[model samples]
Target: MLHALAEQNTPEVRKQARRYAEQRIPLLRGACVPVSKQTPRDLVDDAITDIFLGDGDPWDPNQCDLLTHLRGAILKRTWLEIRHRKLVRYSPFDLAEGDVETVLARERPHASRGDISPIVFASMIELVATELRKIETRDGPAQVILECWQVGFVERREVMLLTGLDDETYKLARERILLRKKYLPPRLVAIVEDLLDRSA
Candidate 1:
């Protein structure tokens, strides 16, 4: 039906698209966990557009029915959007003004009078950044991903889109970064581990 509709430009096809979108709105909304910046209707519309006009993989009727194929596409797009929202909004390194103090207090509870200097915290962050820069020297994607993170674009798809990196390159760059983390300062590692633990 989609292939046939793609060959024609008619009001009925447009109406059918709208009807399909309307019917899937509830399903999209339910599947879009944690809510996304794009509404369910928007996702449905975009999926319809991709199926009909985008250069994505052509829908295979032999593999699945239209609604089933649409459900898969809508869910995939919705999850990607949700993941983007989560990554953009939540960064382990985004230490607000007082967050550093809280971390110091927790990590250095035995310190003399809880007077951990902010300079120490700042240096830890810089050390981690420097280590990442070292990794960047070997992997261009590492640098691109870091820059993207600094500017609030951390989702895999968005990072790939912005940097024009394919999946394999991005995965390898990430693996390199993760591998380099073992060489980071112990204090920095401890701090990151603690942050991850708390976030989890």
Candidate 2:
């Protein structure tokens, strides 16, 4: 089909072909975290490496290369970079921090479009909610909230995946999210906690 599109020189068809190409295993792995913690996101990242590059070491900068690294098994295709000394928007690593203030302090900038639709936000919230379940069952409710505040609203992966951004678009969108912390305040995490409690 892609060959047919290229041979026919249909720009519209080529665009769809690009979408098809992007939807391969890497993107799918890039989209979702595993349903298990013993699973680890780095293993997923390494699996993405194995799938895309046929090697397993995503954490090694010298041995493996990609545009970004998710920093472990849970974050196969996601990663973070310092937008500035004052800001960082790497979702996977952002959540990896041990302190809630550290995670919450790393706020995403605001864009008019960052106001994600309720259905989409609900879905992302559910994802977080599910992860929270694992954490809470293993730890305790306060620990869960602490973890929530740590990586709360500045979750770049949720924003990035929902937007399905290309590299340039991701740059613009992430930078905008970093600059507009007021729009992406850490407080929104509290709402997620309430949701979890209600469900419990």
**Model 2: CA > 4 A from native:** 1-34, 39-45, 48-120, 123-176, 185-187, 191-200
State TM-scores per candidate. Answer: 0.39, 0.23
- In terms of TM-score, the best-performing candidate is 1
lDDT of 1 by residue, 24-106 (tens): 33222222233233344465566667777854556776665555555566655654664564455433453446554365555
Pairs in steric clash, model 1: none
Maximum-lDDT candidate: 1
> Each candidate's lDDT (Cα)?
0.56, 0.35
Count of backbone collisions in candidate 1:
0
